[model samples]
Target: MKRIVAAAAAALVLAAVAACFVYWDTVRSWLPQEVAAVLGAETEDGGGERDRSAVAVRLAPVELATALDRFETSAEVTAAEAVEITSEVAGRVETVLVEDGQRLEKGAPVIRFDDASEQAAVNAARAALAEAEAALGRSQFLFEKGVATEARLETDRAARSTARAELEAAQARLEDRRVRAPFAGEVGFVAVDEGAYLSPGQEIVRLKTTDDLRLRFDLPLEVAEQAAGIGALRLVSGPEGCRQARLLTVSPLGDPTSRTRRFEAALPDGCDLTPGAFITVAAVTGRCPEAVFVPHKAVERRGFESFVFRAEETDAGLKARRTLVKTGVLTGRRIEIREGLDEGDRVVAEGLQKIEDGAAIRPAGEEARR
Candidate 1:
């Protein structure tokens, strides 16, 4: 029994030693080669840093759209002219001649108020005028024949004048019952229908001239300065439809919160553009005689600072230098470089993550042209 136990113990010790060898080999492969060498494992490069390649900078013709000074504003489309059609007298709206969205001509009848009261008043005034004239004639005949006193004749003349004035007032009141279009425009918000009661001064319809439209937009202070030099503003539709408009008005005061200025352009003749449609406005502010522009994606931001990498071919090899650039206006994918880089400098547009200062680089896509 003692001899058998001694043999089993020896076998168990050998198995444990074999298991430890396998574990150490697996663990060594999982570690970084440099770390493994430091920990007494065999690795290449004598555990030194490994050299790698980074993205090279490219120089090419980048078509840049010179960003003009424009006030980036929020404005609504408005009619160049608008008038409110209201009921002049209090009465039931007997008939509405036009509906909402109807194009109307100047002096067109828009609404008609109940004219019964006005007509009655007119008739009453006529009767009173006739009575007064009859009295005046009778007094004149009696006075000429010396049968009436001059004081009585004067009284009769005054009554005749009073009656005539009332007649004119009644006639004017009758005209007020018929509402006429003050100007040519499209009818809007026709709230009253036939037989709807409307008080005096109640809104009947809004007439807005669509022949000319006015668009208003706000511009930031940065671009608002250019407005003084610009004679007009240009607006373009989403599909590149262009329209030129005269500078109608601009706000004298700037917004305290946004420091933005308000500007308006008048479309003298309204085209396919309608009120309330959003369109882009371009106003040339100032020009930079010599400026360098680059692809916007090439610039990276860290906090408030922006930076880019310039490719340099050193004696050792190709590498990059971190450069800080001041950016101006950004249009589409390109940004205007206000400072930091010269016009001939090359910048990395892609694979920026793999680049570091003094890191070796090789061009990946297009070849850099001088």
Candidate 2:
């Protein structure tokens, strides 16, 4: 009975050993190859003949040009000349010569005041002058005939001069009743209509000369320094493409609170832009001749560490090496490569997800492993 139990135990142990050998032998060979396969793909830089087939990478010719750092700023539109019209005389408004929003010529009559009193005064003065002149003629004749004294003739002459002066003064007062435009402009809403009583120095209307419209904006101090020498900057209306302007002035002093420089630009005549319409201003600040740029996607930053991929040819063919790089300004989709790269160095642009360091790869030209 004991020998039968020992035989059963021996058979169980042998069978377990055989099964373990079968599994290990079959899987071990494929394990190394499968694990390294992923590494191989990631390490393959897409430049070599094998790399070209592994991933489709298109190359672009590098060009030399200036790159701008675009900044969006808030701006305001202002009229070049605006004025509030006021009446200078005290009287009843006889007639409002111009309507609201009417374009007026320089020196055009804008408002008329009642001048009947002044006209009546002028008539009275004229009659008085005629009576005085007759008396003066009689006095002169008497003085010449040796009947009147010289003093009496002088008194009659003075009275005639006073009457003439009074008539001239009344006519001048009548002219003051008509208010004319100080300059050519478009009139705003008239505050007082015809027949409204106007006191001295009452506001009448607002007038604006809109021949040259302006767009004023403030820029940062650093940006202003670079653009200070630019005499004229070109302005394109956003999306509308309907208007443009030239630089007018740059303020020497900056705002205390905002710490920004102020600038003004003028639009040409017949421009469709209206005052108070917001627009963008582009100021170019020259170029950097020694700048080297790369795709923004190729750079990866973790903590304080920044890295890029560099492709090189090896005995096993092309491979990607992770390289640490220092970078500069990022203009659009490209970034300036300050270090860790040189001209003509091939880089990986896409398909970096599966790549691993020191992995064996079946690139475009290399044969697939069995």
Candidate 3:
């Protein structure tokens, strides 16, 4: 009786297994594709000859897109005027006229050296010049009156000329004692203090014009030709908002190492940017009014030729047609198909290596829809 019960249980288990096998297709249809595939599902379309051998692939469409002909590159901000401040004459600093980050006008005093000595020297030279001038006048009068020799008049004239030269020299030296700004700008720093000795050519500060800035950058060789037509640009760095820049100039010589051309654009008025600040520049080179774009993965290059597996609908199912295509600008994820492609054409976006020319294919999403 126990053996009879065991045999009946075994028969019931076998019947259940057979029922599951018979309904496996119906069960797989309810499950997800990944789960169904794991359970030995057929990789095919609905009851078609091509579907029996169809390869699973993801599809992307080749459609007309507005291709904005533009490029982005690194750039730097430049000042209208920038100079390193240094004293022309060595002296003891009487006072530092400017501090770090000070705004000043042209000819504004940056540092005042010990000008007392310079002033005294200038005064003495002026007195000597006045005396020499008086003596020269007297000597000229005497010579005219036959009371002085011609050689005496000549000597007086020479003395007067030498005195004038000495006075001018003293005045120049006095001017050197007070270091002034060459242009209206903001100063970086004043390194010296009152009563501190400063050597000639020692950097006192750096003066840079903060407004009317410019952008300088190198443009690629391919787009450098359009530098002329690209008159305006947009800067992508600095501040919260973006502003436009006008084309200033392009260097005649190209960079040998980068194989690019240098470009400069003038920033607008009231710009907050300063010299040496880095920026990103965007410029429009050209535009393609009508262009067929495809996913970059769909296109592959073998040696000299480039090709894409485009999906072609047939009575049996979809087939991958290995179509040769001419490629254009490849920016980001989309690639421009210059030739051999049109709008509404579907191309394989994923699993490109698994499929070959004329290979049967089924859209991976088709299973989910069914």
Candidate 4:
């Protein structure tokens, strides 16, 4: 019985030894050669400073650059003054004086109506007024000589007043037959020909004062407030090129659907921008004179706090020191470092995930040099 128990114990010990050797071989095959060597070295050396120098990263020097935050939006060009010409009185057109695309001064003759009947009425009213005046004069003379009563003299005076009012009305009717330009502008097109009958409020032509233009644009509510302080805005059009415009006014209310505000700017004179032209508006909202900037990859965010790995040179080697940074505007792939960084400071731009605070580093390329 003792001999049988000894043989079983020996078998169990040999089986456990075989299992341990198989596990060791599998683990060794899975590990990379260099990683295995490094692991073996660290284990042999009791995990010393050599493990800290294994991280490789790329570095970039902080640079002084101009940073601008701007708002770009599309706009439309409109004339400073534009109106549709229309007739105020119904009449038969006798003559059309102005042609299409004709520039005219204020009070220039545009159209004339047939005024023969109106002229005859004015003449008849003038004759009646003269007769009433003569009768009034005679009645006054008779009243002073005791030949006419006071009631007769009053009647004569009333007749003269009525005749005068009638004559004035007749003259006004004659004047309305001549249609003239209300303001100085270029005419668009004549809608009526010679002898064409027109009613009141009928469109004649469109007049536009194009010497100066109004640039209309919409901006986001947040950006609109910043744009208000800008001295001038740039208007860009394909055919008219770029021109400077001064802000005139902004809408008091914002659009609820788009959450944008409307703004109008007055363009300078002599620009070839016509009404309804499409344009691009550019306004600089903020600018930094000497902003310190670094590549965006260098910045890492942990919750609300932003930090970067600064490449600090030490007697041992290049070390990555975690630095808390205050950042401003982010333009493209670069970010503005407002605090905790200075120009010419080296920062780790790549391979930051494998590094920690005060970890030794090997720079990847020549970008580390100032």
Whole-model lDDT per candidate: 0.75, 0.71, 0.84, 0.84
How well is each residue in 233-341 modelled by candidate 4, as lDDT tens digits?
A: 8765435544788999999899999999999998877777667778787878988889999999999999999999998988877889999999877788999998999
The parts of candidate 4 lying over 4 Å away from their true place are 1-64, 210-212, 235-243, 269-273, 276-280, 288-370
Candidate scoring better on TM-score of 3 and 4? 3
What's the ranking of the predictions by lDDT, best on top?
A: 4, 3, 1, 2
Candidate closer to the true structure by TM-score (higher is better), 2 or 4: 4
Candidate 3, superposed: residue stretches over 4 Å from native: 1-31, 34-54, 90-94, 114-117, 133-161, 189-202, 237-242, 296-333, 339-345, 353-361, 367-370
Model 2 local distance difference test score: 0.71
lDDT of 3 at 126: 100
TM-score of 2: 0.56
lDDT of 1 at 195: 86
Tens digits of per-residue lDDT, candidate 2, 1-370, equal 9999999999999999999979765765465443344345445543345443333222222323455544455566667887778877899999988887798989999888998998898899889999999999999999999999999999999999999998888888887888888888888668888899998889988877767677789898877887767755556454355345677799999888998999887766776655657877675666667666777777788899877666666786656677788876678788877678876765555435445444333322122342
lDDT of each residue in 1-370, candidate 1, tens digit only? 9989999999999999999989987897697543343443113335333222233344333333455434444456778887777777788888889987899888999877788988999999999999999999999999999999999999999999999999999989988888999899898778788989888788888889888888888877766777856777666542234466678788888999999888887765536666667777676667765667889888899999998877776876567788898988777778887777775677777767866777766554225211
Alpha-carbon RMSD of each model? 9.8, 10.8, 5.6, 12.0
Number of the candidate with higher TM-score, 1 or 3: 3
Per-prediction TM-score to the true structure, in the order listed: 0.71, 0.56, 0.72, 0.58
Which of the numbered candidates is closest to the native, going by highest TM-score? 3
Q: Model 4 misses residue 227 by how many Å? A: 0.8
Winner of 2 and 4 under lDDT: 4
What lDDT, from 0 to 1, does candidate 4 have?
A: 0.84
List the lowest-lDDT window of 10 residues for candidate 3: 37-46
Q: What's the CA error at residue 185 for candidate 1, in Å?
A: 2.4
